[model samples]
Target chain A: MTELALAIENLSFAYGAKKALDDVSFDVRPGECTILLGPNGAGKSTLFSLITHLYDSRQGRIALCGFDIKKQSLKALARLGVVFQQTTLDPDLSVTQNLRYHAALHGIGRKAADNRIQEELERLNMFERRGEKVRQLNGGHRRRVEIARALLHRPSLLLLDEPTVGLDVPSRQAIVEHVHALVKEQNLAVLWATHLIDEIAADDSLVVLHRGQIKAKGKLDYVLQTTGANDAGEVFNKLTEGHKG
Target chain B: MRLLHYWRAMMGIVGRELLRFLHQRERFISALVRPLVWLFVFAAGFRAALGVAISPPYETYILYEVYITPGLIGMILLFNGMQSSLSMVYDREMGSMRMLMVCPLPRWFLLGSKLIAGTAVGVLQSYAFLGIAWAYDIQAPLMGYVWILPALVLVGMMLGALGLLLSSLIRQLENFAGVMNFVIFPLFFMSTALYPLWKIKESSEILHTLAHYNPFSQAVELIRFALYEQFNLDALIFTALSFFVFMSAAIFGYNPSKGMMVRKGGGAP
Candidate 1:
């Protein structure tokens, strides 16, 4: 219970002359949703890449469930479940096949994999659609299948990168609610990246990322109080308005 | 216990390739049609122009189809390799590749598994082409069929690794078509795939030297020997070396430390 699901320290990444992330540090503990709020080009994707070891961090370190990403990448990655901003499902494959394939990748046995797949699909309320191809599903339902796939491995940390990007308003609200429910139900740590102010609840942990730096980080109320703002919308404006010029 | 996971991962990759192959029916048709066209149309046209002498692997004068069958097999593998690489580029852009890399396997193992999967498809395409050729009464020794399996696999790995290396270097799908022309034509025409090195030597010394050194020629010769149940140690060694070198280059090009040099897509995982 004392262990953080994810920990990053002084992580930085550069692409040629451009610095994408600089000295960014944070921790995501179990059973909480940490909303990483940032606008476009604010390095949210870059940070996720580094965290997932898409690109190696030259100047800092990252650990997942106490496993170092650079030195112990397999162990670190084993504890992580990720859904990219873009839909990663195979359009020709049925939902159960996709989930089973993911479970195989995680080294889960056939019997255990099938059990977990059934459990996850039922939890996500998509068990009836398990036999349908991914192409047959709507965007919102597809996202739900991806969520079910991510949970098949029982990962401690679940990372969602702008998951609700192209979904409708109701779909977006429902996904946020579903993920919130997951945190309470499974004790999973989630770092959900989004620019939508409405997604950040007053009690949620919040981190405002601007210009590749963490401008503010704390509980929503604490961040609002520290910035002398009335709400998250105002606080975001106050923290990022200076960089627009 | 860990071995079970590796086996599952390998099967998963191979199963996915087969599934994709089935979905894209055009790919399978085109893969077979290209080699069959060469065997029927191109070989018939060249039969009158090119003369065959009794080579070591050949006991009697053979028809043009018999002479170039191994070369056509190599062509199928070459195209399949590039096609697999094209899909890799597409997958990288579409984000499924990131999902693959995030699995708790070593990066080399992941890449190797992908190469093996692609090679399996290439080998299958070659056998299909062989089966079609059999319908025309062109048959190898029955024992040669079994012996040719390993040679086809080796050639497949060599060509597929070459494709993987190219995919790592070439980022954009729009730019890949041009690369196919540069790579496939030069490899096919300059090698012993179309004409023997001896014939090229008779035409031009420079072309002869190039064909002598071409790894594709070595691969074609390897298959040609295996078709007759003969062994060529030199061809085997050269192909094994090419596989190692090309696979190493691919692994390096996809390395995370050298991010900017490869994978132009942003924020890849």
Candidate 2:
């Protein structure tokens, strides 16, 4: 059996008295992509923050490859890579510099970092543009650079928070395909958060979150069967429509 | 192995900071220009207004340019510290701070590395400023230049800590102007940057005491004495204490739970 790369148990978070993520729990096994589908302000960002330990979660536990985030944050974070919703690249720095800086932060040796950087950039077909400043790259290419940077440390689990937010249809489709290919080719566990519906493939696992609660979670077919819906659109509406407050 | 990672992390941060500094040509020019204006214009205006007495370092009367040269170096470092913190605020807004914070190292180490980077930049600016001043004939003992390096680092770290603490306290980019007006100005004016404490004492006892206690005053004094190849023990102790206090406050202010950063979460715009 494939081991779970990420595990969230009884995770709940709040902003003052307002509940953001309530009693949410889930797991993503290696070699699979779990889509976290939610509307804006549906606590998806909060969940990512808790997993990344950017925001402390008072109520539950997060584990990466069986390492508890709270007690073993260093080990947990060491094994995890993230691409936040916003682009984090420095526009003035070259692509190679950005990747090298990230690799150094992860403690990869310089020679090892160079090899990994070359490998990831080559795999993404961005090796030729490695010397170009990030500002010179188009949006899709920047996203590709971010993905390559995320994989430079060879993380077991990669969390992409709406990685295709502003891309064109082809760019979005290409990124989604690339991630799915990574999962299949390398057994990389991915927890991709997105509000876009068209990006979800039939074989991907689905977790529907609304009003700070998990309404449904499982394989797409299983979620559809349990929600009594024809497709993901109806299932999403069934889980979220009236709850908008 | 972990130690190696920490070392690399620091090098990465410092390298990025230097690269950014190099890319921004206007910043380097402005950093140098600010102090030069003070040296040539402000000092020239105050030349006849103040009288210099024989002191340990100055065996005879000195020019206002010579008197304020060390203070000018302090100013370069001071502005650079605040400027680095301004970048920190920008980095936070741009999502790069989150990138730095999630590096799997302890938070304090991350912060400490950033402070080291900022200090290194400040020291580099100081050397550049000093070179220009030396060429302009605002002379110091030949050995004074070498001896002042450590003093520059300490003063840079202190001011950088103050700036870091301020960045953690201020939430928005718009609020940073308030920091410049409130924190930076007061620290610069109330200190011995432009005038000695005795000069302030002659004007008002309260102002003298404020200048004496101001950490910036201690920082300036630390650098001022070192520029003459002398050491001020009181200034050393005071600046060191302030560094600890400010850095501790910064570390606490940057704590994710109680910090200004976490309230917005990672989806910060």
Candidate 3:
């Protein structure tokens, strides 16, 4: 079995007396593409925030590669890379410059950072547009650039919070495809948060989060087979609906 | 590599901010013009009305334009400080601000980088304003030019850190403009930026003493005296204390633990 990439236990979060994430617990294994699927306002975003150190959790613990999140956040964050829901890029900066700054923040080498940037941009087929300002790039291209930027540090655990929020179908599929390959190729652990079910593959692992609780979490096929449905989408709807009920 | 990484990150922030400033050419133009207007129009009308007198730094008759140059420099720093805070609020609204806090570097270093970047922008703007003062034939002490550089850098850092502190503590951009008018303008007006303490003393001893104790006044006088190749110990001490206060606030604002300054009014995230 691959080592546990992330372990969150008995975690609870409150937003001014309103419990956003209550009694939440889950584990994502290495080389796994575990999708945290739920509808809007179902605590998916809140959970992502807690994982990324956006806000401290009220109770329980968060561990990244066995390192306590609070005790060793730098070490935890060093191994972790996140792409936020909205575009976090500075629109005024060139694409290359944006990546360069991100690389700098992670303390990457000048020569190495330049080379990796070129390599990742080429991987996404965005090399020609490197020097263009971020405003000049289309939405799809910018999403691709963001994905490439997330991978720049070679993070072991990657988190994307509604990464395809504003993208078209093709762009969304491309991001999913790219992420799937990276997870397998690098044996990286990934927590992909989204409200869309089409993005989750049949064999991929799935965790259905509804109103701050994990109703069901297992292999996608196992979760679907238990529903006795033809496609994972139909089963996903049933699971989420039952979760709310 | 780490140091180089910091330099690159810092320069990149500066580059991005400069590019954004370029896009808003009207803003740069207007901000630059306000002080020039004060220098040429207001000072010209007030110069003769105020009459020339023997001031400590003044070797002979001095123009109002020359008297207000250092104060105007202080104004540039003041406004630039608020503008940086404005950008921080703007970025927070746009969600890009969190990207900055999430960097893998020590959070303080990342904040320090932003402070330096903003300070560089403020210093450059201050220097441009000073160039116009030079065109008015205002005589600054020759050695004062050298001293002014470090002085501006210090003032810029102090003001920038205050802005950082505000950005961290502020809940929304809506309240920032009010803070600018209430806090920043008062700090500028009540200071020695516009008129000397002796001039202010004629009106009220309370006002003169307040001006003397004002942190911003110290900043102004420090720059003012530096312009005349003089350094007051009181000004230096006050400036250092102000720096320590704002720098500590910024540190508290950015602390990953045991800090309430940054978390006071923000959303859960």
Candidate 4:
């Protein structure tokens, strides 16, 4: 009965003669964490680009919180937050400064932005380091600041594109746990793209994308049952058979 | 409320540029140094070789440094424009530009804000160069300093918009060096920035025509006239038209559906 946080229908994209994404369709609901599982070069980033409106495709329709991305981009984008695979934070800026910039981009006032920055940083156990430049922080702390920036506006949906790729295990684990907690506590919708199976919680949703197509999608157990696989890794391997990287 | 959002976003972008400019002392120094070198060394050497007839911007016979001061100001705007473009390319490669592009505002507004921000920096550098020129005894009319501000903003936006257009066309950071050599040098050398259009005509009519039509020439003329509290209708129209053209092209080039974004698969190659 609740509105979907994100919806993509019949999405297709191509780079000249090569197809990047083909007829991909999926949905993410509030209070859910949807893990997009794919190997390298499996069109995961392409999908993120489309949903974020970084790339446009004529053959598809994408909606964020009931607003079409093409027709109402401002409203649609206002409901979305993203942390790209590469670090988008200004390295020379302090953590708070970076967050304030993002908050300003979203039209948050200074006072409200400060409060939100503190709340997000404190939640991530990064409040004590807000004054440090992002360049001075280790990889883990930088990612935490990025996460805080992404949540500064408190969007209805969050899209993270391989956010944990270069991070160590503990940092990776901390982000995974924090995002899961956010979903549960705030009823936020999250579509996180990553190849790491260990990041998938038992009750989370799964969408296995392979070679630009959605191979299997649903609850974790549903995907396992449909693919006849024993676990998340098995499901991924089965769905993307012969294309393993 | 909506207007407030747009105002805040512009302030944020401009403030960030100012902060970045402040932090990069080398960039500031180099921006000033480039023009200062041309004024102190290059102009001094050419003073004997070049004599100025009474031009509209020059009421009486002038020293070469005084004549070339406006051109040097143009040089500052031109180089700052290219430098801003280079940074845009770098930001694209480093992924910071994507953050700006994804903001919940119209694409034209965002690009325009960037153009405005770059122009602000360019204008700052222009004023700094003018200050140094003043101390060096090459002074303009007192009110000329104030009049030149609007002219500098217009020309800076025109040059900065051109830079934005180039950034969209350039696919990689490595390719930008070619732009500097091929684009920047030709624009600087062929324009009246260094030589008067009449002097250029004495040598080659073709080169004179090219220099006459160069937007950079119009920009320099605009600044020169403004510094003397004079108005140049021709330069005003040409520079404004050029700004519109370059800015529109840049906005189109950054469009997600049809621009370089589609060709590059949404980000730097």
Over 4 Å off, model 1:
A242-245, B259-269
lDDT of 1 by residue, B1-269 (tens): 78998889888888888888888889999999998999999998999889888886889998888999999999999998899899888887788888888888887888898899999999989999899999887899988888999999999999999998888887778889999999999999999988888889999999999888888999999999998999999999999999999999988877777733324546363
Interface RMSD of each: 1.9, 2.2, 3.0, 1.7
Q: Backbone collision count in every prediction?
A: 0, 0, 0, 0
Model 3 residue B130 distance off true place after TM-score fit, in angstroms: 1.8
lDDT of each residue in A1-245, candidate 4, tens digit only = 99999998999989887898999999999999999999998998888877877777689899999999999999999999998999989987788888989998999999999999999999999999999888999888888898889889889999999999989999999999999999999999999999998999998999989999999999999988887889998888888884665
Candidate maximizing lDDT = 4
TM-score of each: 0.97, 0.97, 0.92, 0.99
- For model 4, residues B90-134, the per-residue Cα lDDT tens digits are 998888888898889988998888889989999999998999999
lDDT of 4 at A191: 96
Which ten residues in a row are the worst by lDDT in model 2 chain A? Answer: A236-245
Model 2 stretches astray by more than 4 angstroms = A242-245, B55-57, B263-269
**Model 2, DockQ value?**
0.66
Question: Considering every candidate listed, which one attains the maximal TM-score?
Answer: 4
C-alpha lDDT (0 to 100) for residue B190 of candidate 1 = 96
Instruction: Go through the candidates in order and give each one's C-alpha lDDT.
Output: 0.88, 0.88, 0.80, 0.91
lDDT of 2 at B101: 82
Candidate 1 per-residue lDDT, tens place, A1-245, comes to 57999898998877766888889998999998999988888899988888888888888889999999999999999899999999988988888888878888888988999898888888778999999999999999999999998888889999999999989999999899999999988899999998888888766899889888999998898998899999988877888884441
Pairs of colliding residues, candidate 4? none
Q: Model 2: what TM-score? A: 0.97
DockQ measured for candidate 4? 0.69
